[model samples]
Target: MHDSIFIKSLFNTLYFVFIGTPFVIAFQLATALILNIEVKGINIFRTLYYLPYLVPMVASVIIWIIIFGHTGVVNQILGLVGLGPFDWIQNVHLIKPVIIAMGMWAAGSGILIFLAGLKGVPTHLYEVAKIDGAGPIKRFIHVTLPMITPTILFSVVMQSIAYFQMFTESYILNKGGPDYASTTYLVNTYNTAFRDFDFGLAMAQSWILFIIILIITLIVMRSSKSWVYYEAGNGR
Candidate 1:
């Protein structure tokens, strides 16, 4: 029984990670790339993009719930477009997309990290690429990507950790209802501990999450030496 419960919780955690991490990473990387370009009012845009990250998690989730509710802004917009009201959080097929959308709203930290990495990339490397007739695409492939691999890996690890603990949105928005569509591992563990008073199982689940995170982090670190480049004379 204990082993079965552990396996179930592990599967749930992995499910959340798989569903969420790609969206977070892709959105952050896109935002970072856009912000890295030379443009007017970039700082203002960056601040706006990052504003959601500053909002408390509970408050953010509440705000999203209001926006995605049946009579909320989203349905209202759909009505304006002559479409019937649709349930967002309550729809099993839409719940994951809704969560991914919400997660994208708080991707500012990752964008900022990537931007910093972009800035630190040696200008001379780009110049060398240009001298060798490398176009923007080539430059990005040979110079930008290799230099930013560390930042990308770091953001992936951090976001994976965050997504593994996702519970607030599901709890506040749908309470993991609609046939357990948004029943993340963290929510399940919380329900087990508080609602069911299964303290021992909760404790075991928590340790399992901790061990999973530790193992993944160690794997990332072990793999980093091969591709993550540090500047010469700077031991990072």
Candidate 2:
């Protein structure tokens, strides 16, 4: 905690998690809801949504680089708007958001999980809710949401854990450059071990990370009782 670098990286990591995870979760769930509806050739739409996740990280980063790099596609558009270009990768203010956007690209798996959860929601519950005069939003709140709480819990915990260890997106993009603007705790820990060869500090960082993850996961699990509902009445 006394180490300035450690504190900064931890803050950046927390920033990434707190700022990015909820939007990603909501996006995944919303997309899943749309895709779950009975419609023509929905399988094709699912495949398209999942394709970005399947793309190799190197390829994905390269595409983003071309789009966000100085004088790249974004610059081209900005030029049209009478704004020449900003150094996206080198800008301290922008790189984190770019990395967060990269994180958003990997929401395909979460979407699939939510889709499965939606599918598992018993149709009879919706019928009962409709018979009770529940409108669409009320039916969703009263029937679909409660039934899917377990899935939401799973997604939330998993997303939080994943974001806590976020590295590659930052690492590949200039190795968390622009004066460490994008460096996360995991990235810093990695450099401490492999790049700087400070095994002692690296080990300490690892333990700290473990504690953080454990505490957050336990907190979420404990809090699940208020929101999550399981079929067997577990953690109700």
Candidate 3:
């Protein structure tokens, strides 16, 4: 039973990160780009965009719980579309997507980081790209993206580590329920140690999670050299 739970939790954790990180990064980058635009009241817009990140994680989770529960706002919206209520946190296939959706609540921090990276990109580089006959898309690909690669790398590594140990939201929202569909590594460790009273097993699980995060982080760092560029002429 322990082995089965452990293996299942590990696979679920991996699946969550792999499926969620891209969406998180994309949304963060898109927000950053939109906010980077020079406009009146931009700071207020940025603050509003970041308001969700300012909320405590537990509070955010609670809000999401209410939103995803039966007869909640989400269901009401679906009802408008002639789709009946759907159980979000309980359904096996839908649970991970719900968790992934929850991650978007805190994506404001990533937007801030991406915006900082966008700001650091020198204006002259954009001018040079334009002079070289680069269109908007070409300029973004050749200049904007390469310049922001470090920020992207940082975001990926941080998000991967966080998602690998995802606990609070899953614990509070799903309790790793619906047949353990949401049992991430950290949740499994918690249950093993506290609920099952298997300190040794839980300790082993913790170490395994650590090693997994370390290996994945190292892989990201190593692979970054091929894509991440530094104006200082160093690759990652």
> Please, what's the RMSD in Å of model 3?
1.2
Runs with alpha carbons beyond 4 Å of true place in candidate 1? 1-12, 82-84, 233-236
In the range 9-57, model 1's lDDT, one tens digit per residue, is 4565576687678778878887888988888998999899989999998
> For this target, which candidate reaches the highest TM-score against the unseen true structure?
3
The better candidate by TM-score, 2 or 3, is 3
Predicted candidate 3 versus true structure: per-residue lDDT over 154-232, tens digit per residue: 9999999989978998899889878888889999999999999999988988998889899999999999989899889
TM-score of candidate 2 versus the correct structure, residues matched by position: 0.92
Candidate 3, overall lDDT? 0.91
What clash pairs does model 3 have?
none
**TM-scores of the models, in the order given:** 0.89, 0.92, 0.97
Worst 10 residues of 3 by lDDT: 227-236
Q: Give the lDDT ranking, best first.
A: 3, 2, 1
Best by lDDT, which number?
A: 3
Tell me how far the alpha carbon of residue 193 in candidate 3 is from the true structure, in angstroms, after superposition: 0.3
* Candidate 3 wrong stretches, greater than 4 Å: none
